[model samples]
Target: MEGYSEKQLGILLVAERLFADKGFHGTSVRDIAQEADVNIAMISYYFGSKDKLLEAVFRYRMTATKAFIQDLVDNDTMGPLEKIYSLIDRYVNKMLNEQNFQCIMNREQMNREQSPVKDLIWELKREMMGLMEPIVTRAQEEGTFYKDVDVVLLMSSLFGTIHQVVPAKSYIRSSPEFADMPDDEFVEYLKVRVSAHLKKMFKAILTHEF
Candidate 1:
């Protein structure tokens, strides 16, 4: 988004929504072009092919995420536990706000077809994990968190919970409890609910109480 022109960014945004609504194989170049209101040649000129466009979509969403995590990791003012809480909040807000991109990510990961997009996702996960490890290590070293904490599972639990909840809004709203909330209200409610739940869950998992 930073480097791309207005037209290019517009196409990426359009393609991202289309890819999320329609599966990658189900969405064609013409579909993206039509939705983006550009000629197919523009897509070809900007991204080269459908596969590369898909890759660009992933990169577009993940680039900011990578930078944010890196900044959180490098930040010295926040304590380790505080950083973890902040991380949880950032992810919850991001997933809630960018539900379409998250949907694309979840769908592509489940897809069995091997592609560069899949590889890129894994690569990004690894890099983020690498950035996050130091926070865990810092906490454990300071006796603020337990030594036995599994970073992978900890992240999996955090992300898995968010992933489960974001896509289940319809099911959740069917219940009398959340049935009447407006869409904006529901999302804000989810952000608070999920963030608090995750922070508490992590505190228990990382602290000696467990």
Candidate 2:
């Protein structure tokens, strides 16, 4: 816990929380310095500026994504479909657990034109599509999905499916039919719903090879 300098960890902790609670422009170096109990000058000394700190945060987020994707790509224990499921599970779990972080990510993406982390955002997206491509290719050859589907289109649909979940969660939870369910039950219900979509998409792609 004490290994890395407090200032470094401080930068990450403060940046993510602020970036999630308030948009980038709404957060400032002074705020982060105060929250992290470090000098404002230290932040600049370590990260150059608030903008650089924000970019560092996006880079940190990508590290987690990269690790899981790399493991799935390299692991021989699980087949292609299982690897895909594992990937989806991690992605969905993060969203379900961190609604604020999810919201922040989407906001940053929408405002990428002004974001300090725009390059990292684009790279994260392109890397995600690249990760899916090989799995989809392998699945098609293995008769797991369709051969005629467009890879990019299919990837877009996957992103769309996951992204839509957050916006609809409030609506679904407040509805009379779903309101009675417990929180865990509600998430499980969603898991099944998304899994069904994944299966349906998998089947569709099987018929065509997206």
Candidate 3:
């Protein structure tokens, strides 16, 4: 018999991999059990069911995200652009090392389920948004961003761009132009791109909004 504690981690590891590659509906308990080198009975004994195990994988990613964003926000010395770089850096670095982390999030969202995990997912999103909102609001209020900018819209723009990076990384990495870009180089490019866009938007608003 598999050790109970080891089986739990094993199931999660396999489940996350399968979930990332094939999604929740695509992966099965048997696939996970086989990958983990454990018996299906052990999976049930540890997680009770496949759904529970899947949820745990999602929770793990969100927990890591919370810690990352919190750690960055704790550093007030980081300039707005630096903060953006930090955010992108952490995200890219995480993806480069543990691509499964990002895959799990994107896959879960694709499910579009109305299950109990819905609330947990929403709560996790709220934490990220809350972490981001204050920074944007402060920047706008302090005239770093253009006045009259919509905080919600800005927040969406920032996160939407960053969020797309994960699911599309393979495509980007395969592209000739991006194929040669290392993780740090890619993060810097993102920083430049995001900063340039926001700056242009701010200037446009300054010349047009008022």
Candidate 4:
């Protein structure tokens, strides 16, 4: 969002929504131009190409998140477990609040096409794993966490558990109990329920009783 101007941001936002709704290959540059009420030349001038624009979307969404997590991990005030919980909480909030981006990401992963955004996704994931490994290792060394824990497996457990809910909202909302609930309220429910569940799982994993 920082490097983009108002016009560029507007176009990128439209592209993100469209990309989420329709797969990247399905959404055309003309569609983005019409949706953003801009000419094709403007998009080309700003982002160079459709693939580049998608990359920009990834950069726009992920750069700040990576920086935030890095800061949280680097902070000396919070311990390893505190940082882990903070990371989990932040991730849940991101998935709920930024559903469009989440959808775009999920769709990209599901798509078998060679997308440039996939590289960014994998890079960020690797970076995240690298960032979390030290924290887990430190906790284990300090005897606060069990030795021989699989950091990647632990991360996947949290990621998989939270992500599985995004695609099931339709059936979940179709249920009688959730029928009357507003989307926002349901997402709030998700935040609370998921946060508690992950915390419990993380506690079990760290304590090595699982």
Q: What is the C-alpha lDDT profile of model 1 across 85-162, one tens digit per residue?
A: 999999999999998899889888999887659889999999999999999998789888889999999999999999
In angstroms, the error of model 4 at 204 is: 0.7
Q: Cα RMSDs of all predictions? A: 1.4, 3.3, 5.5, 1.7
Q: Which consecutive 10 residues in model 2 have the weakest lDDT in total?
A: 201-210
Residue 149 of model 1, lDDT score: 94
Clashes (N, CA, C under 3 Å) per candidate? 0, 11, 0, 0
In model 4, residue pairs whose N, Cα or C atoms come closer than 3 Å (at least 3 residues apart or on different chains), thus clashing, are: none
**CA shift at 125, candidate 1, in angstroms?**
0.4
Prediction 2 TM-score vs. true: 0.81
Residue 88 accuracy (lDDT) in model 3: 53
Q: For residues 69-138, what per-residue lDDT tens digits would candidate 2 score against the true structure?
A: 8778778788777776677677767666666666678888788367777777788888877876787688
Ranking according to lDDT, highest score first: 1, 4, 2, 3
Q: Which stretches of candidate 4 lie over 4 Å from their true place?
A: none
Off by over 4 Å in 3: 1-7, 95-104, 112-116, 162-210
Q: Pick the candidate with the highest TM-score.
A: 1
Task: Give the per-residue Cα lDDT of candidate 4 at 145.
Answer: 92
lDDT of 3 by residue, 1-210 (tens): 133366576678778888778877778899988888888898888788877886777676667777777766677788654665566555545555566756666556666665435566778778887886665567666777556767556556555665776566566657688877897787667556655655555345433432
* Worst-scoring 10-residue span by lDDT in model 4: 165-174
lDDT of 4 by residue, 62-108 (tens): 88888887797678899877888888899999888888998898888
